[model samples]
Target: MIPSVPTLHSERFRLRPLVRDDARALFPTLGDPQQCLYLTRPAFGSEEELWGWLAEPGWNGRTWIAEDGEGEVVARVVAVPTDDPEVEEIGYITCAHRQGEGIARECTAALLAYLLGEEGKREVIAEVDAENIASIRLLDRLGFHRSALHIAFEETHKGVCDVAIYTLSRER
Candidate 1:
């Protein structure tokens, strides 16, 4: 199993674990259809459902909540282990109201460092919906290059969608 999640830090945000109370605070954005459009799962129907997901104990990865100075959750990040010991897959979701504020970039950069340094992962990859231009741009800014190998399409709750893979190596 992955080691206990640790609190990470950035210039303007603190990345830590989610609390029960955070489910309520994040429901608005996480439950919104627009925010879940590119996700494999559909928008959560209620705060309780989102809470249940957060409460799951057998998570195969590490997760963190990016909180601003005021302690509000601005975004969530997850890094899942893959078959290759040197690699991990990552994902992030930003609160709707907090988009375009550089929170994702800063917090995710910290996450990348932790994964590559402390976690001993040599490479990190992110899989995003092909149509998610914003996320694709973010991955690019983070120095993740689009991998030639990608899913042509996958049938998910959102119907068939093209998926793209991006990767960042520790040496870079």
Candidate 2:
């Protein structure tokens, strides 16, 4: 069965379903070479790819478009079930222009609450590049404890960078 759609809200942002039409808004962030630093894929080439991934079935994942009070899409937060049913990894990215505004933190906290409080998920995990101090700090504020640091499995210029693993349990 398909997973239920996820919609979460915070004091300053709302997380809603990511749609194909968001490509135009997403391109600015996704297409930036600097923004793609820690990401697995370089850059999305077309809207079709975005739509196709969002529409895939049997995938236990949901991507939310993070919108500000003005209803402008500023970033995206995603949670996807891993091989272990009790664990899901989370990821988020905000527009470079909107950095330092607490957008990612707000959305991440909201998403965590929605998953653990509403959806009954057990654990939420995140892997961050060691150099991405901003992301690491955000995760820390959300109660994600560091579990490990390892070389990333994905290849990039930073081939063997330190990865900080974080986890939040449902019991918390």
Candidate 3:
């Protein structure tokens, strides 16, 4: 089981576990149809629903909220372990206003370090929509290699989408 992380730091951002109150700040980006298409998660029905999910307890992973120096949430990241014990899958989403600012890259680096160093993780995986060029590129930049593809893993507002799997090991 992945333990709850207190708070992680990067050059320009701080990441902490998502909480019930974050719903309002996160609604605009996470609820946007354009942004929700790539994420497997559906747009929340209400802040109450978001609170429920936020407060739900699970052993798989923890979702983190990235905040700037002023403590305003700027993005979100998740690190969930697959059935494989030593392998963990990670996903990241940047707030609409913060896209293309390398926030994903920076936050992911911190996650990797914590996972590999502090969490004793051996491998990290990422699943992205086949058509999400930017995410594919981001995974590549982070040293993840394409590993497999899942056909029709989920349906999105755009249509049924294929899931592209990528992997990164502790050593390279």
Candidate 4:
């Protein structure tokens, strides 16, 4: 059975499923232009936009939010299925001011452990803009291998660009 979204405890934060109430705490990081520079989609322009995004269905996967003890949102992670149920796609977004602080790594590790260990996923996938070096490095640190780059995968801060796909298998 699929497990219910559970609160995960990391050394510095508590990770829980993303909820609508998190909109205010997450906007600064999610809307920062510098942070969204290589994102596939444009930076959120308003709280309304962020809310719309947070409210959208996850395409059948889980979305987690990492918060400090004071309840400030520090990072976000998501693992959603692609066309194949055994393969899941993961996403991470750290607040702008919190970048370079290892928040993404902490949150993603927690999410992956649950998804691959308890959930029985065969692989975890991530598609990032080719110019997104930060994300590429994070995936590498997490043991993901480069799969392929799709031509003109999506429009981004650099205009239409190739998307690099990375994957990590359970056996690895």
> Which candidate number would show the highest TM-score if scored against the true structure?
1
| Best-to-worst ranking by lDDT | 1, 3, 4, 2
RMSD of each: 1.2, 2.2, 1.8, 2.0
* Residue-wise C-alpha lDDT for candidate 3, range 1-172, written one tens digit per residue: 3567679999999999877778888778766777777766777777777677666765467888999999888888888878877888898888888898999999998888898888888999998999999999999998999999999887876779999999999988
Give the residue spans of candidate 3 off by over 4 A.
none
* Global lDDT of each candidate: 0.89, 0.80, 0.85, 0.84
Number of backbone collisions per candidate: 0, 0, 0, 0
RMSD of 2: 2.2
Hey, what RMSD does candidate 3 come out at?
1.8
Q: Model 4: how far is 60 from its true place, Å?
A: 3.4
Off by over 4 Å in 4: 1-3, 57-59
Pairwise lDDT winner, candidates 1 and 4: 1
lDDT score of residue 29 within candidate 1 = 92
- TM-scores for all candidates? 0.95, 0.87, 0.91, 0.90
lDDT of 3 at 86: 84
What residue pairs clash in candidate 4, if any at all?
none
Alpha carbon deviation, residue 49, candidate 3 (Å):
2.4
